[model samples]
Target: MRITSKVLITLLIVVAITACFSLITHLSNESQPVGDEIPARILISQTPLSTPLFVAKKLGLFKLHGIDITLIPCNGGVECMSMMTHGKAQYATISESVAMFNSFRDTDFSIISTFVTSDDDLKLLALPRRGFTSIRDLKGKSIGVIKSSASEFYLDSLLLASGMKPTDIERVYLKPDKLIQMMKIGKVDAISSWEPWGYRAQATMDVVNLGFQGMYTLSFNLATMNRKDETSHERSKRILAALQQAITWIQDHPEKAKAIVSDTLNIENNQLDWMWRDYVFRLSMTNVLLANLQLQARWALEHNLVEGKQPDLRSILDRSALQAMQDEVVGQ
Candidate 1:
């Protein structure tokens, strides 16, 4: 009887220990991304910024990294950042300025990487008949700009760069896509915008490049909402890893990469060729980018673009996912 009671007690203890471990294992599995899990959602702007993302989707790079992506196409970075701001989407491809502007409202957001720098991507085009061949020529002419966008601010930068003030020129507000058509018809003397609209306008309208001053280039960045969940963090790292790989593939195969972007967007050959030169794609956030962000933030503040009194540079750059990915690569 004594032996029977001891055996039963020992069996009960073993069963309890096994059950505890089993429960732990189950919870652990639930926290990690499953191989057959649904695709992670990312809001992407329809621009060169999303070219690599499209390539990744086409090449199955995201799936290779165990991150199936569902891309929600947005017209511009403002809309893209809005999705992140509302928590409707966790990730987006946005302009450094757009991200910087929105970061004022939410500290939970961060720019993980700056993937492209535009040199001459932001261009100033003049109507050929206007004979406005330089930025100085636009001193008193009305310029078309997309209000509430980098277009408007960049026009200010262009003017300031040329020793002119915003007050020196009248600003005509127009959407980026419509700027070209309006300019072609003489609606505005000059238009300031980013590619491929800039490229498209120059080509279609016999417009002259007043300035390819995209030298003070607007950069495009990958941003996300920083979540506390381990799963979310893990997924973010995977997304970056996949993007890094896609960028590598893009560099090594320029023609192929262009084809991917062109085909996806159904772009004309000339437009694709011309606009492609303006983009320099890579993954990084440099001092130049930081400085640009700061400058733009101040511009936004002065323009009443944000409610915050000042910019928060720290909140804008949450590199935790980037650092985590680097550590993982090192570990591997």
Candidate 2:
């Protein structure tokens, strides 16, 4: 009887210990952060506009927010958008102009958020020795621009603003680096492109800035495939959150942020200093962005850049991620 009682007591104690261990393990697993099991690839351009992404990756903010990000480098937003469209990356950083041009043909992706905005990012650089000292000199001259890009749009806008038409110049379509090279070799009289290409052109060759600042406001945005599933929605939120944190850190530490951007882009610190003040870094979907898209769409249609009737621009925006975080998503 004594042995039986002792065995029964020992069994009960063992069962209690095992139960406690199981409960603790279950709670521990439940308390762990979710969403790090899968790695996410984001296509980013080698520009200061993508500073937040660089900062976020460098500081491990993505991991802090439960996401693993692999940054894929691209030449420009157009390339990044293309890579994202082909399923090469889960996300891409693009300018609003890229989104606008694509919205005419496809609704396969959505602009998740606009992380940065700058009016002076796109510049019209001219070769002074080629008798191109002013914006007006671009007339009848070969101008290098990236077709279907903010570079093209800004060039057109600059020309229009300067009382010249798009047809006034010979449009030399080329990649950003090629444009810079063409400018260096005097192959093109002027090149309208975004920084750091613009900065690179000035740094490498004797180029003059035509000084058409504030002609266009370029929004650097995040884009993902148009997925409305729960998984996609959650993933978007995680990315935005990580970016928001990065933006905050950037605002708090401007010098450090600039250093990070300079290092990431392999550009000189002076280049960043020249354009740092032009950029407004934050996470928002504002009325201004919507209106800019509408304006760009109108420009595209007027210029025959897109043939069909303007697709509903609002449909291309996925604000659920921004809204989920209680962030300000103004103007739909």
Residue range 1-332, candidate 2, lDDT tens digits: 25698899999999999999999998775345555545789999988999999999998878877887789999999999998999999899999999999998898899989999998998888878878778887778898999999998888888888889888999999988798888787788888898888878878878888957788889999999887677788778888878887898999999999999888878888999989999999888888888989999999999998889998889888888988865432421
Deviation from native of the Cα of residue 206 in model 1, angstroms: 0.8
Tens-digit lDDT string for candidate 1 (164-194): 8878888898876788888777788888877
Query: Clashing residue pairs in candidate 2, if any?
Result: none
Q: What is the TM-score of each candidate against the true structure?
A: 0.83, 0.87
Q: Candidate 1, which ten residues in sequence have the lowest lDDT sum?
A: 29-38
> Could you give me the TM-score of model 1 versus the true structure?
0.83
Summed over model 2, clashes come to 0
Clashes of each: 0, 0
TM-score of 2: 0.87
After TM-score superposition, what is the CA distance of residue 177 in candidate 1 from its true location, in Å? 1.6
Residue pair clashes in candidate 1: none
